[model samples]
Target: MSAAAARRGAEVVLGLCAFTHDSAAALLVDGHLVGFVEEERLNGVKHTNSYPANAIAWLLDQAGLAREDVTTVAYNFAGRHYLRPLLHVPAHLVDRLTQTRAIPRARSFVTVHHRYRARMAQVRSQFPKAYLQSVLHHRAHALYAFLSSGYDEAAVLVVDSLGEIQSTTTWHANPTLQLLHAINDPASLGYAYGAITEHLGWRRGDEEGTVMALAAIGDPARFRPLMSRAIRLTRDGFALDPALLPLRVLSSRYGRVTSAFTAATCPPRRPDAQVESVHADLAAALQERTEQVMLHLAYRARGTSGSGLLCLGGGVAMNCVAVGRILQEGYFDEVHMPPAPADSGTAIGAAAAVWSDTTGRAPGGLTQRSYLGPAYPGVILSTAPRPGLSARRLTEPARELARNLAEGQIIGLFTGPVEAGPRALGNRSILASPLTDDVVKRLNATVKFREPFRPFAPVVLADKAADYFALNQLSPYMSIAVPATTLSQTVLPAVVHANGRARVQTVTQEQHPFLAELLAAFAELTGHPVLINTSLNIKGKPIAGTPELALDCLTESGLDGLLLEGWWVTRC
Candidate 1:
């Protein structure tokens, strides 16, 4: 082939994840990620598992491509794994027929085979000219972490509720990824944590972060023995005791812990029930146990791979507390986590995996900026003020916004491209002075409508991060927690958690110039370079994706002002 022909033959892959929470689509042009966005952001559904039709369309539109432009369509889940569940159906049925406490088992294996096949068919129909391929779920997760880490070599870990039959997988990526260990379903730290989250009166996949927050204020020793029995750590990996954790029962739509667990501990809390001290203690116990298991696995990974760096992905990695513990232990000299270290990120991984397999080269140099979603230019919003609101373009957004924040105004900031991951990262964030008294309470009650105990995160200037937080490495994506310095706890009280730690995102000029500038400007005014940063949405909603959604959030919430690209909008 001629050089031009060879270049044209390079794959344009469209990666997708559906039939699971946080469905998303990603576009990769010749193995490099060009765009990615979650379905929840576009559809306004929190943790929607529906096919990412909107996300795919938006990616193509943003890239100025057509369906025919895609040479490959890669799905983040391997449909062949449905056979495992199918094979268990007979055993489940036998248990159901015997009425030997197996009804739940039968329901758990309720065939998702047909649904998965239909979703595959839909994908094929959507991209008629493209070849469709399936990537193993955990492998996709591993590749996403390693490729985005920018590490030449690292030890990789992926822990989730269930990826096909495997729940936790370990890998060594010495520029070429290789699987080292795997723990299959029914023995997942992710499942154990989810069960505890459900038992604590929150949705499993959706509200695990709440359980993490509750853990900080509670006493882990109160329920340590019981939690240890429920999730026992082994030499290689952890195991979830079926008699206590009951993976089948917990995995069902109506999540419930086993009777043994209930007998040993307190009954499950209802969603609307008041949270008591016991519940907090249970959360703490679960968190502590999870941290222990994570550390154990990290040690094993280091010994097995002999890599000085670590990369983490999958839903379980969303537990920043556990990730923080790993960082604090210093088992690895460096740790890297992608912004979307969950199912949503599998889209990028699937595309990258397919590209590597086809081209015989890994996707190289894909920076972890995570600003690959839709971008709305500042000109998109009209200059005219809306009813009950005033709008004007700011000459110096950083200085003006810093001034507003210094005066104790909570501002909704919407600019640049929407972020691909769960973290706001300044482009789509609600910013407030972390030093403001009662700021956390006000943000939870008036703006977020979330539990009062839920703590907000802080985005700090990269150079000044270590002065405030005792993080071993920079956390550009808010991926891990770190101990707050005494100065930070005193000066930035709103962002500090009860445990005297904070999930911090450090911004450099290269990574996020606007956020860095704003932090510097705020520092000049308030003598602190940190700001209380959270997603630009209320609780139970995805972050605002568009100008209209951003405006809607501003009008609905108790925000003092909003920055819509260049325009500054405030209520009259």
Candidate 2:
């Protein structure tokens, strides 16, 4: 507690970010996080690219308080009113007005800042008494990483598409945060990667994961020489050399893109069509170069902060493959990153900043679980069950469901509160047997209906986690990737990625009693405690929060059953 806190007692703070990719709301009582929910989770819309009205209402409702109870309200974006002049020009208008990355970046900033302030007006009207503070983009990202990392003195690095005017920021944060270095617009590593994604006929923000997955199949060395011309390392940091970049052509859909990045003048719309050796090599090179920049920045941060721990945030930090590379370097004693490393988690950072300001102290620690969304009442046991589907309310869902799982059933498990972030953490997930690759192919082909090459993550019983994967960290959110042993891979072939690693979500009985019960039952049945657990949604859709959405997935997809809350629902 600080001097101010000693006098004022406890306070409630609300943190918000809207008009962003992952719109979210976070609530904090004193210094502890009470709830954090993304708009996408509740709305059933992927990315939820607008104001989080539903998320905010839930945050206040969950805490049993009204908007007036919040002493402070924190917003994620800053410098909007000041930076609007820099941004008012149209996106490609700068290219027509003055052909440079800086001008287009100005255009981008204007659009972002104006929209943010307009939304805040509505928020302010709702909570007139709460003291509102707007947090800087990179500052929020840094503070969130530091507080969530459980490190006392940690080096924090944030790299994203664009944050206000800058794209990359390196900081040494503890009591007082100091900026080590920052890389400005147009020369963004994040934008460079996004441009490549566009060139390869993929969605800029959404399909970066596909590029990461394809990297494992390609030879990074094939494109290493070419990538060098585009980016080079400097004494202080790295540089994005525009001269070496391809000539960008403006598109209505894509702001500024280059046709020369690909072999075709107009490529097929399907990303799967661009999955050949050339594209693979490009992806490999991109991943390799990105890892190089990240490792260098991390090592530099180690020295700058003089701390043994490192925490990374921003959209770039979501690249688990690159993150795995950094984990291998052994440069820092420990590294930590939250599950929602991207913009959504910034809501939490905004709240943390308010707490730090009022209390004159840093709340630096870690949160272990992520089932933070609203929970449902008891699922009604329908007397008149739907045709072609059987229903039974079970006292022991784990034991009953384990038998079905052993017989190769795909069941939708809905229980407790909804998960807050991008990843689904058992509370809202579709489960399948991990014994064979056929189940994965079935999941991709019939259930997810997305990319064939995209991999499924697993939820392992926590005690059995070390036996399967290399590390024993409490990966409750499947954020980190670790190599799986050959023996375990052979047994659990469905969940392992092409790169020989698995993004594992480990759950203990203490944290997730329902999931632990199911895992234990599966172990008793088949002697294996792993399940192919993926978010319960079709491709291009958000995970289901409401029971109706979960039911819809069961009917639309090839799912065999629906274990919703307490009532067991299965196809006849």
**lDDT of all predictions:** 0.85, 0.77
Largest lDDT belongs to which candidate? 1
What's each prediction's TM-score? 0.95, 0.89
Clash number for candidate 2:
1
Query: Can you write out model 1's per-residue Cα lDDT over 404-443, one digit (the tens) per residue?
Result: 9999889999988888788898889999998788788889
Which ranges in model 1 have alpha carbons more than 4 Å from their true place?
Answer: 1-10, 85-110, 249-254, 383-385
What's the residue-level lDDT of 140 in candidate 2? 85
Residue pairs clashing in model 2 are 87-110
For each of the candidates, the C-alpha root-mean-square deviation to the true structure, in angstroms, is 2.9, 4.2
